[model samples]
Structures are given as structure tokens and as C-alpha cells.
Target chain A: MKKEMVCISCPMGCHLTVEGEGDNWTVTGNSCKNGERYGIQEMTDPRRILPTTVVIKGAMISRLPVKTAQEIPKGKLFDAMDELSKVVVEAPVKVGDVVLKNVCDTGIDVIATKTMPAV
Target chain B: MYDIIVIGGGPAGLAAAVEAKKEGVDNILILERDRELGGILNQCIHNGFGLHTFKEQLTGPEYAGRYIDMAMDLKIPYKLNTMVLDMERKDDDTKVVHAINEEDGYMALEAKAVILTMGCRERTAGAIGIPGFRPAGVFTAGTAQRFINMEGYMTGKEVVILGSGDIGLIMARRMTLEGAHVKCVCEIMPYSNGLTRNIVQCLDDFNIPLKLSHTITFIHGKDRVEAVDVTQVDENLKPIPGTTETIPCDTLLLSVGLIPENEISRGAGVEIDRRTQGPSISELCETNLPGVFAAGNVVHVHDLVDFVSQEAALAGKGAARYVKGHLEEDINFTTVNGDGIGNVVPEKITVANLDDSVNCYMRVRKVSTDTVINCYIGDEKIATKKARKFVPAEMVNFKIKKSDLEKYHDGELKFVVEPKEA
Candidate 1:
């Protein structure tokens, strides 16, 4: 199998051509090792770190920005978004505070990116 | 009098204030119109920031938090919810900042040096003059970003984003995550103005079609945006007849362009650059007014936050040097934008300001392959940068070494992009 993709690891944006399967993959047209790894990742279990906001009560702002603790499967993005949208965190929340654990059964926790103090 | 007065508490302002404090400038003040110190970063929750500065891909809020922490660690005093009304350069060479806030009604503060980091504002539908009703669902891309990322509100369900700017690309993904069907992103230009990474991750990842060289000719609906007439354009960006396609969408987001918020800079008698619509500055980020410096989007729009932080640091150092009586007052040369170049920041350059190297940030006017950028100083080639391809979306930083100058010609320093013949 051959897969053509662009590496989003950096702004260099190397176009990668991934061929073969599993550990026997051959990635070409990559400028760096990150692109090679990204090609392999894409061919394998493609994952992405989802960053979104959830409801925050009594905070200076209405929403609190949070991101997945680990990269979740790309297919599970909207599932994670669906799971995260249901969450309502409170103010006085510190950065790195876990907003939701095991989101979408992906075993990745959603943590706060900003420190919100109660208004 | 304060040693340095940093305007706006965003990444640029925070970085400037922190760097000035590190430069041993004791009396420093930061005035932010927003209630929070992070400014736009507070609402920009997406990752891909701080790669150059922190060497890690961090979210916008996280990136801003690092600088905010740095400012707090240095005990830099900042006033929130304070709007700068005007700035005046007194005869004694000091600056009086007129500002108003709930805490400090209308007050005038004196400072030896001022750094302008008021940032930029998004161009709205009205600015673009799209043929449409002053509708309800039509929002600027940045405004929609704020609504979804900070206010916890979605702008619309079925959306058609006009202008494939980075903000619009970002919004296409943000809106998609919240269960909105992003129909497509339309760009009148032959290419997308947004970065390659954004086009790939935001639009491509979601399988959203990007119709290039196409523009919305007419918007339908009275109270809100309903459908827009999308039409393909010629090489000159003029819409072609018999090529109109109407896409039904509840929301129409315009990601046209950004204008620098520099009313106060003009009040201070700082010269403005027509192309950038921002304050023109020296290599030290100092404006024509000796003690006044400008950086970040207030000088010219930047593609990355790390560059903004880096540029602001230069302005901070410039302010510190000005306050310490070390900064040069003599303007050596004005930078000229030659063929194929869009805009260049630090429109002026001073001999004394050049250290190891000076960074000149710019964007190309259009797409070209095998591009060679030549930097000239009074008929002398000072620097050259070769890139496989240069696009308008990415900013090119051309560094001119102090050693390259050898002797100051005291004339125009120009940058011209030379494209390889096909």
C-alpha cells in the first residue's frame, strides 16, 4: 500500500510518500526524521491531540480551554469532542487540572490549559 | 516617570515588559484594554504556538501563560481594562500617556520610553463591502473564534467561510468539532493566504474543500446569512461571468484581513507605513519618535506567535536602551519594498542599533518558485536569501549582519525577490 501525505509536524511541510506496511514501511520525500515518523504514524494508528473548550461556571470567562492528555485516535475526535462538550468545569481551576478522565474510552484525560480564577 | 510603558498586555506587550524588566528597567507599566492580561491568546485555544520560543508546541493560552508568568515573576505592574486614549511626546523628550479605566478614570502618566503593541484588528464584512444585508449570522473569523473558543457559543451550523485566511481555516475546524457542517472555504486569490500547516490540518483533515480563485459575489438573506453566490475569478481577481455557484449556508464568516490598531501611535506623531497600515520603525523597533518603539502586529502582521514575542523583545530592549540614553536617535536608512515583495517591517534602520544581526520580517506579494531575495544598501548587495519556493502565506525573515554593512552608506536598504525564469 502507498499513501501520499503532507507532514504537519512543522512549517517546513515536506510531502511524504509512505509505502509498505507496519515496521517494513518506507517513507520518502521527507526533509527530516519527524516527517518520516509522521508518515509512519499516519499509516499506522493515526492520532491527533484535540484541543477544545468546555463550560466553566463562575469564572472570568464562560469557557475553559482544555486539551487531551495524550493523542487520541483521529476517528475518536468528534467522540472526544462530544464527551468534552458534556463537561462543565468550575472556576479556581488550575492549569493541568483534569477536566475529564478517560474521555471517549480513549484513556486520555482532558486537562485545563488556562488557570481560571472565580469571579 | 516610568522607565518603560508597554501598551497592550498581549503576548507582544507581555514579552516586551518582561524583557525590559530583565534589562534592569525598574519602573515599567503595561496597559491592556482587555480585562485579562493574555489579550487574544486567552481565546486562542488551539495548539501550534511557542514552537520557536519555548521549543514546544503549546496552545495559545498556554503560550501566553508562560509570558504572563514571566511578567508576574518579574513583578511587572500592569493595569487591566485600561484604554489608551492618546500619547503625546512632550518637549522634554518624555511621553505622556492619556488613558481611562474604571479604576483610574482619566489619567495621564509620564514615561521616558513607550512600546506600542496594541496588536491588530480583524477586517469585517463591512470592510470588504460584500453585497449582503448587515446580517446576523455573518461574523468575522476572529469573532467566531472568540465565540466558540472563549464564549462557549457556536457561530452557526452550516457555514461557508469567505477568504481562506488562517483564522477562517482554524474556524472551519473549530466549528466542525462542535458538529457544524463546514461547506467550504472560498479564496479569491489563486492560493490560500493561510499557512500550509493550517490548510492541511484544519481543512484537509476534515475533508473540507478549499475552492481557490473563487469569491462570494452576493449574499442572500435579510436578517441573517442564508446562501452566498460563489464565483471563480480570473488571474486579475475579477469574477468571471457564467461561473456562479450558490452554496446554502446559515453562517458566512469573512477572514479578509487585519488592520493594525495604531490610533495612539498616530497621536504620538509616529510615521505610518501604507502597505502594512502600521507604525514604521527602526531596526531597534523605535519609531520616528526617538523614544517611541513599535513591534508585533502593530508594526506588521506576523504568521506565528513566537515571532511576535521575539519582535516584542527587540522593542523592549530598544525601550530599555532609550531610557538608559544609549539608543541611537539618528535614522540611517529607510527600507524599500522592491518587486514581488508585499510588506517589510522595521521600515527604518539605524547604524547604532545593529548588533550581531538585524531581522527584517516580510511576506511575498505572490507565489513564486526558485526565488532568490537580494538585500541592497546603496548599490551594495548586503544580504541574499535563497528559497526553493516563496509564498505569500509564510513570512520570510531576512537577517542582515552588522558585519555585512561594513560601512554605513546612509541611504535606502531595499529587498527584491528575483524569481527563476520558467
Candidate 2:
């Protein structure tokens, strides 16, 4: 079976065609090698870096923006978000500070992207 | 009296203030209208920012935080929630910034040089003239982003975005993640006005249909949004009579475009560029008026925040030079938009003030493939840059070396896009 997908690796947005299923795949129509990798990963097991905000206490603002340190399994995005929703951290949180350690046991930590100074 | 006063504490202002301080300007003040310093970046919670500056993909707030930290570390004084009312040139070459806030009732700031970085505002439904009742469900894409990301409020259950801009595309995915059914994104233009990555990651990833060359003709809503009439347009963007389709959606998000907020700049008697709708500036980012400089979105809407910081840094350095009495007064050669180019920043350039090279940021009017951008000083071609693909959504910067300008000292520098073969 042939599957068609657009590579989101860069601004090029190459329209890729994968000729095989599972581990054996031949990707074409990619401008570069990264697009081929993206196409294959997208077909086999897609993953994305979840970027969102979590509630904060004693900060100038009500919420602190966060994202997974690395890309996680696509199926675990909502689960990670659900875990993030339950978190509440204090102010004086610096960027890269772990908001949720090993979020949803995906071995990926949810870290604060911006610093929140104590109000 | 301050040596430099930066209006708007967003990315541009913060970067300007920090750069001015590094340039040995001791007294600098940043006046921000918002209570916080980040500006619109506070609500822009999505990633894919600061890739050039920081060499990493960061969220909007994160990209802003790095600069905010730098400003704070440099001890840059900034007034929060202070709205600048007016600015006027004084007799002694200094400008006075009059602002009002709850803390400071009314104060006039005296500065040797002023940097305007007030940024841009989202164009609303009224700007587009969509035939509709003033409904509660209609919101700008940025406003919806603020509501969902910062305020933690759900905008709607069913959504129909009216533009394929980056904000609208991001919101389609954002609304989807939060359990909103995004029906479709409508763009009047044949090509999307957003980055191709956004079109793929935000829309294609979520299976959201993007209808190009289509527009919303009529919005059917009274108190709340009920439905919107979508229609396919002809080449001239006129709605075809039989192509109307009604999509029942509770919310309509408008992401038409952004206009630079330059009310204060106009009030200060700064010359406005008819094409950019921002301040007409030199290569050094100096405006028409002496001792006044403009950068970032107030000068023109930048596609990336990294470019905004880079441009604002130049303005800061320019302000420092003006204050220190080191800036050179040289004859400037005007820059003109030639074929296929929409507009170019730094409408003029002075040869003496340039260090090594000057980066001219510009956008093409439309998408072109296998094109060469040629910079001609009068009839003599000075430099040429080739691109595989060029789109209006992405800004292209061409660096012209001082050596190139020295060859053609007194002619108009025109940038034109031509076929690669030609």
C-alpha cells in the first residue's frame, strides 16, 4: 500500500510518498534525507513535542508555558496534557525547570519554557 | 532626562533597551502599555519560535523571557501599564514622551533619542467588512489564542476560521486539541499567507481542510454565531454566485492580517510609508525626524521575532550614536521596489554609516519558483541572490556589502525579482 504525506520537518513541506508499510518503506518526493526520516516515522510511530501551559501559583501571571523536553508518542499527547492540567507550581520557576517529571511515565519531562518570577 | 526611551516593552523594545545599554547608554526607560513585558508573546503559547536567535525551537513566552531576563540583568528601568499618549519634538533635539498610568498619574519623559517598537495589532472583522451581525462568538485569532492559552477559557465548540494565517492555522489545531471541531479554514488568496510548516503541522496533521481561493460571504449570527456562508472566489476575488456553502459553526475566528500600531509615531510627525503602513526609516533604522528611530513591527510587520530583535538592535545602536554625537551625516541613496517585490525595509541607506554590509528585508508580492533576486544600483547590477522558492509569507533578507555600495555611490538601489534564466 502506498501512503502520501507532507513532511513537516521544515518550511519546504515536501509531499512525500511511502511505498511500503511497517519497517520496510521507500520514501520519495522528499527534498532532503530528513524528510524521508520524517515520512517513515510519521507512518510507523508518529510523535510530537506537546507545547502548552500549566497553572502557576504566586506568579505575576496565572499560567506558566511549558513543553515536553523532547517529542513523545503521538497517542500520549492528551494523556500528557491531562497530567499537565493537574500540576500547579510556585513562582520563581526558571526556564527548563521540570514542571512534571517523567510525565505520564513517558520518560519525557514537561519543562517550563519561560521564567515566572514570584509576585 | 533619559538618554534613550523605548516605547512598548515587547520583544523589540526589550531588545532595543538592552542593546542601547550595551552601547553605553546609561539612562534608558521602557514604557509598556501592558502590565507585563512580553506583549503579544505572552498569549502565543505555540512552539516554533527563536530558531534563529536561540538555535532552538521555543514557545513565544520562552523566546521573550530570554530577552526580558537580559533586560532585567542589565537593570533596564521599565514602567508597566503606562500608556504613551503623545510625543513631540522639543527645540533642543530631544523628544518628550507624555504617558499616563495608575501609578504615575501624568508624566512627560525627556529623552535624547526615542525608539518606537509598539508592534502591530490584529485586523478585526470590521476591517474586512464581512456582512454579519455583531455576534459574541466572532473573535480575532489572536484574541482567541489569548482566551484559550492565557485565560484558560474555551472559545467555542464548533469553529470556522476565516483566514489561513499562522494564528488561524495554529488555532485550528489548538481548538481541536481542546475538543473543538474546526470545520475549515477559508483563505481568499489562492496561496496561504502562513508558513508551509504551519499548513502541514497545524492543519494537515489534524486533518483540517484549508480552502484556498475561498472567502466568507455572509456570517449568520444574531447574539451568538449560528453559521457562516463560505463561497469560492474568482481570480479577482469576487464571490461566484452559485458557490455559496453554509457551514454551521458556533464561532468564527478572523485572522485576516496585522497592521502596525503607529499612532504615536504619526503623532510625533514621523513620515509613514504608504506600502508598509509603518515609519519610513533609513538603513540605520533612523526615522525622518532627527533623534527618533523606529524598529520591529512599528516599522513593518516581521514574520519572525528573531528579525524583530535584530532590527531593534540596529535602532538601539543608532539611538546610542545619535546620543553620543558619533553618527555620520552622509548622502542617502533611496531604495525602490522593482518587479515582483512588495516592499523593502530601510527605504534609504547611507554608505558612511554602514559597517560592512546592510541587510535589506523584503517580501515578494506572490509566490515564485526558480527566481533570482537582483539588486541594481541604477542600471548596474550590484548583487544577486537565488532562491528555489519564494513566498510572501516568508521574509527574505539580502545583505549588500559596503564594497558594493562604494561602486555605485549616487544611484537609486532597486531590488527586482526576475526569472533565473533572465
Give the winner by DockQ. 1
Superposed model 1: Cα runs more than 4 Å off: B420-422
Residue B35 CA error for candidate 1 (Å)?
Answer: 0.9
Please provide TM-scores, in order, for all candidate models, with all chains considered together: 0.97, 0.95
DockQ of each: 0.82, 0.60
| TM-scores of chain B alone in all candidate structures, in the order given | 0.97, 0.99
Task: Spell out the clash pairs found in candidate 1.
Answer: none
TM-score of chain A of each: 0.92, 0.91
Evaluated against the true structure, the overall lDDT of model 1 is 0.89
State, as a TM-score between 0 and 1, how close model 1 is to the true structure.
0.97
- Candidate 2 lDDT at B167 equals 92
Top model number, lDDT: 2
- The residue-level lDDT of candidate 2 at B141 comes to 98
Candidate 1: residue A20 Cα off by (Å): 2.9
Measured by TM-score, the strongest candidate is 1
